[model samples]
Target: MRLTVLGCSGSVTGPDSPASGYLVTAPDAPPLVVDFGGGVLGALQRHANPNDVTVLLSHLHADHCLDVPGLLVWRRYGPEPAAERALLYGPEDAALRLGTASAEVGGECDDVSDTLEVRGWVDREPVKFGELSVTPFKVFHPPQSYGLRVVDSAGAVLAYSGDTGACSAVEELAQGADVFLCEASWTHDPGNRPVGVHLSGTEAGEVARRAGVGQLLLTHIPPWTSREDVLAEARAAFDGPVRAVNASESFDVVKSGSAVRRQTS
Candidate 1:
């Protein structure tokens, strides 16, 4: 299995980075995408056919999901016919939200929901899409959110903490994962507000350590927090290998004993 970081910024797109989006690939199936934030369409075009892609949304936050409409429109009107037939999966209301938003933007909504299959998330229940097995766990974000554990047929698992504060669901989703792609959207400073909505770098590292993940890929970093500081803080909490993932960075998973070797790609 291979994982690509399409974008890793938090809250909004940065000068050098886009918002949150990722792609997971396995040998037997098409690539799977997570969180199509703004600017991800170009990134998605690089590695796989968007028509064969399966999108898993973490939430409806603009930074996490605003690009769906544009992506759908591009697929529908682009020269590539296959791009218009991709499947989309997310929380129960994702299809409605995407369809409504696309129509609002004057895009085609004729069979958007039918073309995109959106299912309700059930904790611990595995949903299969081609060769990928995904398990979504409810998170602590408002309205609703989910942290996903994606496993390939080779037993390689990549767990993503969509966007949430410290929660048992996040830990469960990350348990024994080959790579933990967690969000570090806030600073470790005690004075920071919106306490339980996002994790700090230290908090993300702790989750990785506790989950016993093979590698830690810190993502969803806010613009204000220096990358150096976040990496330093995460290292202090996690003795294991922790790296800050950049946009377009990729990682390959190889079988190593019972664990998986998650090497940078």
Candidate 2:
């Protein structure tokens, strides 16, 4: 299994990266996309055909899923139109939310089912996508949100904490994962910021420590936050391999429960 970081900018698109998006692929299977955020469509084109990808979203936040309309356009009108309808899995009302966001001037939601088959993910229920199986776990985020535990056919697991605060669900989802792609969207100082919305780098480290993950890849960092500061805070708490995500980098997943990082720049 392979994991690619298409973009990892936190709440908004940064000058160098898009908001939040990832690509998970395995041999002989269609790639799975997680959180098609702003600017991701262009980035995704560099890696794989949008038509052949399955999409999974964590929530309805604009920064996390704003590129669905662009993907729809590509799959429907690109040079080689989609030969098969792609699958999109997300929270309840996903179709309506994404449809509304991709609506035209008339304010009428585009028929996403025209090119993508949408489904709502139920907590802890495994959804099989090719050789990968994904189980969503409810996390602590406003409105509705989930963290994913993805297991390849070979038993390698990759967990993602999609824009969550310090929550038990995150730790449970990340347990024994080969790669923990967690969000670090706030400062370590809780008194200086809001609570129960996003995790600090230190908090991310704590979760990684508790979950005993093999590698911790910190993502969803805002442009205003210093990556060095976040790394330092995370490292202070977790005595394991912890790295910040760079756009377009890939990680090879091993069945032995390790993720080998590969730079794609």
- Total clashing pairs in model 1: 0
Clashing pairs in 2: none
C-alpha TM-score for every candidate: 0.91, 0.96
User: Where does candidate 1 stray beyond 4 Å?
Assistant: 104-111, 257-265
**In model 2, which range of ten residues has the least summed lDDT?**
256-265
How does candidate 2 fare on TM-score? 0.96
What lDDT would candidate 1 get against the real structure? 0.82
Q: Write the per-residue lDDT of candidate 1 for residues 1-265, one digit (tens) a residue.
A: 8888888999899877789999988878767889999888777888776777888898988888888887777667768655345677677888777777777456554347535666667777888877889999999888589999988887888899999999888988999888888998876886856767998888998998899888888999888878888898889998888889888788876545334343554
| Residue 104 shift from truth in candidate 1, angstroms | 4.2
Candidate 2 Cα deviation (angstroms), residue 5:
0.6
RMSD of each: 2.5, 1.3
